[model samples]
Target: MVCATLALALVGCGASVPSPTPTSNRTTSPAVTSSPETTAPADAAAVFPVGEPREIATGLSAPWSIVFVGDSALVSERDSARILELPAGGGVREVGVVEAVQARGEGGLLGLAVDQDRRLYAYSTGGQGNRIQRFALTGTGGSFTLGAAETILDGLPSAGNHNGGRIAFGPDGMLYAGVGDAGSPQNAQDPGSLGGKILRMTPDGGIPSDNPDPASLVYSSGHRNVQGLGWAQDGTMYASEFGQDTWDELNVIVAGGNYGWPDAEGTAGAAGLIDPVLQWRPDEASPSGIAVVAGSVVIANLRGERLTVVPISDPSTAAASYAGEYGRIRDAVLAPDGTLWFVTNNTDGRGDAREGDDRILSVGLAG
Candidate 1:
């Protein structure tokens, strides 16, 4: 469970956990194995109905993000600043270390993106501010190492918390990064600051010429702290944002659009500012990483401690599943096999940890 101290370390002081929603009545699947790996039964999606949640990898500490490379995945540990590889069978091993990461509160190594060429990109808190670095994955199979890294972009603001760090490649092949307000509400509306904005750039970190701002990297602004980014098949981008105290948000991002932050938290209908498609009470959601699964947007939450599945057709009618089962899911990514793989964040100096806590969980989704 998320404690008050964690709320203080994250969104604000005197913050309490949100009220629990009705738990989904579903049967848990057997834990995965190294061989063929335990899979969802024929009635898996029926018995469990929504999806069958199973444990994949365990004993992780503050795992922030995951990017797939073949049947394996590269995961980032927020506090440790190390990238660990979890192979197909099971188990995790360190593949590389990001330099100059000041892992504090929400600032540290966060978000990972892998290109077609297998090059890896990471968003981390550097000495000056948040930076994006690219690393080459050398070798093959279980014998791999992260080669020398090159800084792609830097100088984004960083604070104890609210250092928005979610990076993903758009359908247009442009790199999109989410940045927080760095605890400065003014930055949310400041066009000069990279904070509180979604930036669109080339794979090499160059500003896309087609951006809303020719010389600026800001794709969208006025975000309090955006931690999740996903794209629908139709190219519609969805973002999940943390709120101040009242409400959290799920907005459909658009170029040059502004999502009212300090000016507004949720759907305020403020002129010139775009409103979120879906809004949840602070306790009901503090959404983090998101992935589009089976035509639906799946969001992982921290304070709410659940998985929210929103149909792209009508996001306002989103449903919550696996409430309070795995504890503080920080990130979710679709695997090559069509299953949704997510990492737990209970050991991130917040929630209570179980025997082999901070695990990577999987939910089978039909194609």
Candidate 2:
């Protein structure tokens, strides 16, 4: 095991909300309005009858991201920089560790994406900054090892907090990354700054020609600290962002849309700024990793201490499940057997740790 730094402070910041941009063009009406009782598990039965969350794995420390290879799931531990493989119906084993990983605050190792060819991709913080590295999976379940890692993307801003770290391959076969503002509100609106932006690139880290900006890798800008990225069946993308104090948001990502961040936290119907489809209080929904299940989107909440379910067709009518039942939900992903697998983030030095805290739960959706 390669020893790595373990500075385990949760890296999200809080600031005063800014005034909305004094501009106009778009309608003042919000694109989506979440019902006030979103935190209550009201409409959970309407979408799908979800069973009680079952424990799949335990004793994980700050697990950040998860991706499946064959029947096993590859998970990243943020502080330890260790990649563990959890095979189906078995235990978890440490496969490899990124020695150069600096796991301070919200930095460290985060986000994992596996390609169709079984190649592994990881986002981690290093000496220079946050970067994406690709590796080949060797051997089989319970005996997997990562081949020599090749750095594909680099030069992203890194901080103790606000290090936006979520990566997913879109339906278009392109790689997409969600980055934070790096604690700098100004970076959210700056086109030249990679901070506070959603970047789209090819598997080789090359700029895609279809990007709104030809010369830049930025797909959308003005995001405060986007942590969750999910896609509906039709390729429509949705992202969850951490707001400065008052609000958190769920946004429908457009090619070049500017999600008003520092200038507007939640719903600002000003021109040139896209409003969030749903908004919540930071305490009620400090949302993180999100996944699309059936026709609804499932979100993991860190501070809200619950799992929020939002239907893509009508996001305004949202509901919650297991509110305060689990401690600080982090990542949620769909399993191959029509189950939902997610991780808890209580062991990251913030929440109240339970007896066997920081676990992974598997839930089945019925009807």
Candidate 3:
């Protein structure tokens, strides 16, 4: 096992910093509004890692996301386009392969989500572009398998890299997807483009009537590459984005809010553009999947090789755990039992592959 003991600490909240003024000739959105401050979680001070991480599953090839279905964990392998089931009894089994997945640089089967009705949702790169499909999950335990693939949404954008492919069900039961610019920075600024935006749709792929634009699925816009989306208990949405050369950001997502992407990487404070609540250097935090649990936003970092915990009360300050111990951390999700599960990405051709290569590790959370 590559697991190791690690300690966690929570730092006191600091003074708020002022937003920077817009300095570039970026287009502004008249309808955009400033993101409101996130409401503090009820148990804001209770969440923290208590013990050493335990390896739940290993030998996964480039696992990207994990979702639970009736206590069974489903994981998506990026390049292989395979969906694996990790049963509680032990060992992993192939649920089925995602057909038509065009496995390119960073494009492939990326995110997995399970709805309350036991339907599985997947975001993958298809032959034409990136798409979201729904599958009927059948059987149970080791016998679990996927039914037919029903394409719900398709042809957003696709590229070798920057394919933002995280999908989740919001507290309101709406399906939310994070899409990257697909290597085209201008796509983020185009209102008609679905790339580089957070989209909200009904479970069956219909645009929600309450969406920012009645005719569009765009909930928010101007994102470079948003890979993480989670909601606090109070319904405050948070998203983590990848910046080009300077900064990566954790932002409070608000409807019709425009995040300065091609023009502003981090906290630009540009007029009419919402600035991120917290910004980190790209090397320190190429954060991917995030889970809002207890009172903290737990982020899995790939390049930084750490798990960053941002207290809900103070979004600006953060604490790190397991830095450089397990190599590249890709996804962080809260298990049904309330534990935090994180995936390692050493075998994704970006990090040093340890003996086990990729793995799913869980740690107990206090309170």
Candidate 4:
């Protein structure tokens, strides 16, 4: 019965929404698989969002990521290079601008992450290439400001699109970054290249001793454009990837695992290649930032314009909410209060901008 359901979902219901420009000629069917190590928490399957979404803040221009520092929320604006802070009391203010951010088609100030020491980490496109930097976050609340930028990693491949800028701290306290192929398809297959891989490094930007290659930062490879990284309580890592033309993927990330990119897309069932647990068409799911909540992996979709909830217990099944209700959803994260906070991307030079085109909104969660 589970296999039947999985097969049914492979042929997703097509939506009338416009699809992104095609990047590859691969046309294939969706695939689904189960990982024994990915079982969700006992109470996770019952957790779901309740009530209407409330606006936490508005008037954001092309915001990309949200990370909480204590009671304050820090948001990264993709084109502006400004980090906006939303205090617990309400209202938003600019913390400071990240220097040397180059905003192109899809490259600019992207992911934001906060460490235990109250320091901030950002992944962005720069004059040389894409880089990751750490900053000392000073002050609190409205007076919060960012100290000088400290380069952690730099010289990564960069392009107008497919920059794959998403950074996060894993449960192991190691920094992880998702990088794209930068319009170079062969780069995904090149193990020596930093492009099209998930890199794991220490807080100080050193490669972890236990990394797949002790001297290298590459954790996994063969990814087209990975924009989301999250882990369940059990430490099962999940990622969302943008496919060339055929499908978008939800992959279970493993150390040194090779995901077929230029060779095979969606589910080729090829030997020596890891297939995604679930795949969606580009129009129905241009998945971006994701958050692992309770028992489900919540995904933010751009072309699909929805929040997709996939139960970890049943990886093949999916439930989508607010399809086309909001325009071009970009990022979703679990707020400090357990509510689900999501950012829209209508004002990002794509999609039709609404009155408040790009805003951060939150909805209550219930079990």
Relative to the true structure, how large is the alpha-carbon lDDT of every model?
A: 0.78, 0.79, 0.82, 0.83
Best-fitting candidate, scored by lDDT: 4
How close is every model to the real structure, measured as TM-score? 0.87, 0.87, 0.90, 0.90
* Cα lDDT of model 2 by residue, 155-196, tens digit: 799999999989999998888999898888899898889999
Residues 47-76 of candidate 3 have per-residue lDDT tens digits of: 666567999998999999999886789999
In model 3, the runs with Cα more than 4 Å from the true position are 1-37
Per-residue alpha-carbon lDDT of candidate 4 for residues 50-140, written as tens digits (9 for 90 to 100): 6678999988999999999988899999999999999999999999999989999999999999888999999999999999999999997
Candidate 1 backbone collisions, by pair: 18-283
lDDT of 1 by residue, 1-367 (tens): 1111111112211222232234354212111001000112232221111456788889888899999888888999999999999888877899988988999989999999988788999999999899999999997746669988899999999999899999999899999999999999999999999999999999999988999999999999999999999886656778899998887877778788888888987766456877665667767679999997545778888987877766554333356777788789898888898788888899999888888888998877642
State residue 28's C-alpha deviation in candidate 4, in Å: 21
| Least well predicted 10-residue stretch by lDDT in candidate 1 | 29-38
Rate residue 215 of model 2 by lDDT: 84
